[model samples]
Target: MSKMPTPPTLPTATVRPILDMNAYDGQVSAKADQGNDLLMRRTRNVGAASVLFYRDPIEMVSASGCWMTASDGTNYLDFYNNVPSVGHCHPQVVSAMADQAARLNINSRYLHQTTETYLDRLKATFPDHLENVVLTCSGSEANDLALRTAQRGTGARGIIVTECAYHGNTATVTDISPSAFKRGKLPDHVVSVPAPGKLAYGDDIAGGFADAIVKAIAVLSDRGHGIAALIVDSIFSSDGVFSNPRGFLRLAVAVVHRAGGVFIADEVQPGFGRTGDAFWGFLRHDVTPDIVSMGKPMGNGFPMAGIAVRPELLAAFCEDVGYFNTFAASPVAAATGLAVLDVIRDENLLANAMICGKYLREGLQHLADIDGRISDIRGAGLFLGVDLSPNGAPEDANGQLVGDVINAMRRHRVLIGAAGKYGETLKIRPPLCLRQSEVDFFIEALGKSLRECG
Candidate 1:
């Protein structure tokens, strides 16, 4: 057998100043106006115009490489999206889709080898225990399956999840996700725990988060049976991309299992090489889960999601009832997922994500000296977070400051995003193909934005 050959080294290019800064600024203004005009006249969301007052929602016309061109013909740096894992419209994936579509694009019910092959390829990325896989049309569906499977396997109804975790948008998933649905009204059968905040908790994430879960499980067990499972976003992507004490998940999962609950790692955001050090974000903690829900980057912008369960747990789920999604593991979706995996392995994007993430973290940290608004920096690989606390304190009133920074960054031709209940954290989950130049530009833009906001 031959060892896999190494990928060729990355090439560097110079950014020529052919276009003036004013030229770009004028384009951005025109683009904003155009977007506003169209959205106000044409589109509506919840009976409101597409213009959300947070600036005109970008009518992205097309994207390729690391840039997105809006309907107004102005380009913005694509740094806020993690769904385009291999870069926007990566040629390899695009070509694969075109080739496979011409050849065979069928449903899972059809007899095609690609679906099984793609499933096998995906399975190889997981541990041996997580052998059985169930594909779904989206993360919300994957999570819904995960919840149902966990309940059947554990015979428990209580679910413990991160306080700010955003698993998906379906009814069952929304019940588990308090950040979006349970806000202002607490969720039943759910125990929410705070996300890792170093300054607030003295960096003792393992102690704090674990204690919360332990107490909840004990309370639930005392009242009835134990928790059905504990669901969490491995990187807490929506909760400001938290990366902390490496072994925290290991401890938490053990506790949940000891309490007779399934350990579900929701890798919707950090799966597919976004975490770099491991193929899956939870793997970084050296912990295997009873149920692993994957989405977002799995198909690299396609609506493909899945859950890989421990064989025993899956057996329990299978015995309970027959469950199938119409589009789950469809040939086209499977091909898209397989192509994404190929790009990750062939291009060595895992290592790239880690290297580039470190570069971004260091660059952002350096700006803390220039602008104190950037209070905290945390994450692993391309998943990152920037807290807008004045002195790295958790309760600082920089919520509006963070919003101002995001809007200001838009003016600088860099599109980023913010998260956290207070909306005070810059959630920087760029596609794994992000390069150092883009990171540098983000840092400069962010620093300037912070200064201007002050």
Candidate 2:
């Protein structure tokens, strides 16, 4: 038999591969899919990059609201997807897209009323200083542009990111995303700091996190890559949803600004009222970002994203090269985006998120009281993270236990995923239209899943 490779020594809080968390083993999946034609065909189609959830991946045919219907007709309560933030296949958004496509769906090169109207509505949600909006097709493209703009504005090559941050998959952005690194180390220009959490920063999270940024700035300076930007997901979603101590980001952001670095709030995960307390996650910290890259739920899964940037930064970047996306800011995209915004306001989804989020947290806390395995519960609004530990100790958190519980939850017909550096935190992010009954159902399923895992 071939010798098993020795696992590398990891820190107490190690950086786990983002894509591998709660992901199925390819070799095992291949063996399991021996007789399954669909699964085998999928493997043949996508090959090695085919990353599917669960050991036994379900073929989903249709979805609505918070539930996904599998091919076998079983309904799975979706707690994993955040793409359809306003709820899956919302009628208003679908109608807007279809109508616009039928009427006129031209590129941004031509002036369109719907495009400008959508920009006006979207721009109103951001700070006044962020006067320029550059549309893109995905969060990756948005972030790539933000990075280039930051570099151009500051004339620096360095970036600071959270230890396990997953900004995007673009070649340039990937260099700064530690979680995306499967084997190689981060590029020299990009520096990573421990996530701003109680474990890393103790009592004074704000000060400690800022101090780390200062150190990162110095390191980048020493390497001749002066600070360009401190880009982060304000909620720290990939770093395990660390959304406590409200304004903890203020000090860190100030530190970055002092070092001549711009602040880019990568809101691909936390934007569009998902956090409930504020329209954007950065708003909760009261720190104005030089650039804000948003996607995922922007068009409610319609594949539209953009960056809200300070006018000066955009101007500076534009001086050297022009920026335009052929498919972005189209009449169809604008209409779809407008519909999402209208739904958010008309349906009072933000208020619902706050109400439902509080209820969800309370239920999780109640579960924690009964089950000592649940070590901690963190986050705000609808985006929460539950840490699972063996023997009721945070330091002894077990990813294996978390994986088992996730599988158990799947067996109970509730879909969920994992997060955190150790893959020990349950990443719970349902749609904004989550109701009291759905929260109750999730809580009950979780309790049962915990019991089953035990």
Best by lDDT: 2
* Tens-digit lDDT string for candidate 2 (190-241): 9999999888989899999999999999999999999999999989998889
Would you estimate the TM-scores of all the predictions? 0.88, 0.97
lDDT of 1 by residue, 330-378 (tens): 7778777888889899989999998998998889878865665566778
Candidate 1 residues lying further than 4 Å off, grouped into runs, are: 1-37, 41-53, 182-184, 222-225, 390-392
Q: Predicted candidate 2: what Cα RMSD to the true structure? A: 4.9
Cα lDDT, all candidates: 0.76, 0.91
Clashing pairs in 2: none
TM-score for predicted model 1 compared with the true structure? 0.88
Candidate RMSDs in order: 10.2, 4.9
> Backbone clash tally for model 1?
0
Model 2 lowest lDDT segment of ten:
1-10
